[model samples]
Target: MASLAAGGVVIIGSKLIGGSWAMLFASGGFKVKHYDIEQEQIMNALENIRKELKRLEQADSLKGSLSAEQQPSLISGCSNITEAVEGAMHIQTLLPHQ
Candidate 1:
């Protein structure tokens, strides 16, 4: 099984994007750090993610190999961009092309 030791950074302008990325990475056993400019956006994004996840759970399409606890533990929110990127094996930016 893949381990969560593979750390990742997700820089997003919106919480919706950040949480989606975080959930997928967490399901795949990667530790994820999500960052945005505003904490309120982060909160909103996380809420959206949870709603989607509940739907996924009902449909059984989510990364189902992980336990409930494992999923939440794999993802974290970061206010510091530099700290979020530190020691990350990969970084993905979900921002406007401009």
Candidate 2:
């Protein structure tokens, strides 16, 4: 596993796009914090991201150099927006379409 970068990425909203961006960052050895207002939504996104990361690794389609196991370790769920953005190097927000 690659060493995660300090004050890594923060992805807000925890939707499909947010989850995708989090995975992308994690693959690049960044610790990603995924934030959503709802705890359940954050949890669901984390679970899906983990499963998808594993599947992508098996198919040899995962992005960057980090392995599936390593990527998930770098990604974490956050319900508090302030905490999620604290010390984050990059912040990306993705909200669902109406």
Candidate 3:
């Protein structure tokens, strides 16, 4: 699927893959907010994202040609559903199908 270049939020769940996905979007210059109901998962996701970012830096695959300092600023964590959705032009619900 095509990315939202205008930038938006992404709601993620328990897996590091969610944060990984968020990283991909953020790397594309989109602002991403990753949300997990569990606090531990949120922390894990953020850490995972950082690791992925480091991998990207090593491989030289980040988007917008951002400098190393500019990469970490792309994503943030959200504690509540409201904060996650607020100010987001588009929302990517990462929940699996039932």
Candidate 4:
């Protein structure tokens, strides 16, 4: 996981898929950038991630060593796709297929 500290992940889209991925990586001690066109979506996603993390903690199903409170802190919401991708070691896109 030391490599994860050297570089972060950019997750495009703030829907369920993207948010889930963000939480997954963050729980693993990886920094995560969450991108969404709509600010509302980003806000909602953040809230959802928070709730999910708590639930995981309660269920004792959370991955990695980070606590629930610590995991969400690793994710940042970014409105700009370019900005989110910048300095990211890996990128995951959750856009729907056309």
Candidate 5:
């Protein structure tokens, strides 16, 4: 099992569930790695995360002490699974139902 760096969370997937999980962790002040095989999906996920964070901030419901900008700043997108999981303390993988 891989371990995250202090306050690190690795999200394996860039779909709705994975992205949401990443945002949740980031909002809670965790360093998040948003990973996806498709770069486009990763980009989309990041954009959506930014929007959601802003919404939370505007609603005064954002988690943790970090601002929306700061929270999103803690998340990084990666295509490589190994790199994404490198220093994460927790890993969340979202898989589509077959």
Candidate 6:
């Protein structure tokens, strides 16, 4: 398992950009929490993260020393923004495209 940093990371969105950020942090072995108001969006984002990581691994373009298989363990989905941001080393919020 990746030795997480003291505060870890929290992303306050579950869209494409948010998923990308989560992947980057997770690749660096930092635990990432995806915070979204909708549970279904969080679920979909998790699934997409898995798929994207696998694709990257297959293409020999995955980041970090850990395999795509190992990265998923570093990320989780959360509905409570307050709880998710608690002690988070980094917090990112993405605004919706208007």
For 1-98, candidate 2 gives per-residue lDDT tens digits of 34544677888898888999988888878888998988999999999999999999899898987678878998998888889989888899898777
lDDT of each: 0.70, 0.87, 0.71, 0.89, 0.84, 0.89
Summarize candidate 3's per-residue lDDT along 11-96 as a digit string, tens digits: 66737567767776766677778788888887787777777677778898766566545655777788788878877887766676
lDDT of candidate 4 over 2-81, digit per residue (tens): 36448999999889899989998997789998898899999999999999999999999988898999999999899988
Give, for candidate 6, the lowest lDDT window spanning 10 residues: 1-10
Considering summed lDDT, which 10 consecutive residues are worst modelled in model 3?
Answer: 1-10
How far is 79's C-alpha from truth in model 3 (Å)?
Answer: 1.6
**Cα lDDT for residue 37, model 6?**
85
List CA RMSD, all candidates. Answer: 2.1, 2.0, 3.4, 1.2, 3.5, 1.9
Of models 5 and 6, which has the larger TM-score?
A: 6
Residue 22 shift from truth in candidate 1, angstroms: 1.9
TM-score of every candidate relative to the true structure: 0.79, 0.89, 0.77, 0.93, 0.88, 0.91
Q: Let me know the TM-score candidate 6 reaches against the reference structure.
A: 0.91
Rank candidates by TM-score, best first: 4, 6, 2, 5, 1, 3
1-98: candidate 5 lDDT, tens digit per residue? 11234757888888899988987787667788888889999999999999998998999888877898898898989988888888667888897777
Model 3 residue 61 lDDT score: 74
Selected candidate, larger TM-score, 2 vs 4: 4
Q: Candidate 1 lDDT, tens digit per residue, 8-97?
A: 646556555657777887777777777788877777766676667667777778775876556766667787888878898878878756
Better of 3 and 6 by TM-score: 6
Better of 3 and 6 by lDDT: 6
How many clashes (backbone N, Cα, C below 3 Å) per candidate? 0, 0, 0, 0, 4, 0
**Candidate 1: residue pairs that collide:** none
How far out, in Å, is residue 22 in model 6? 0.4
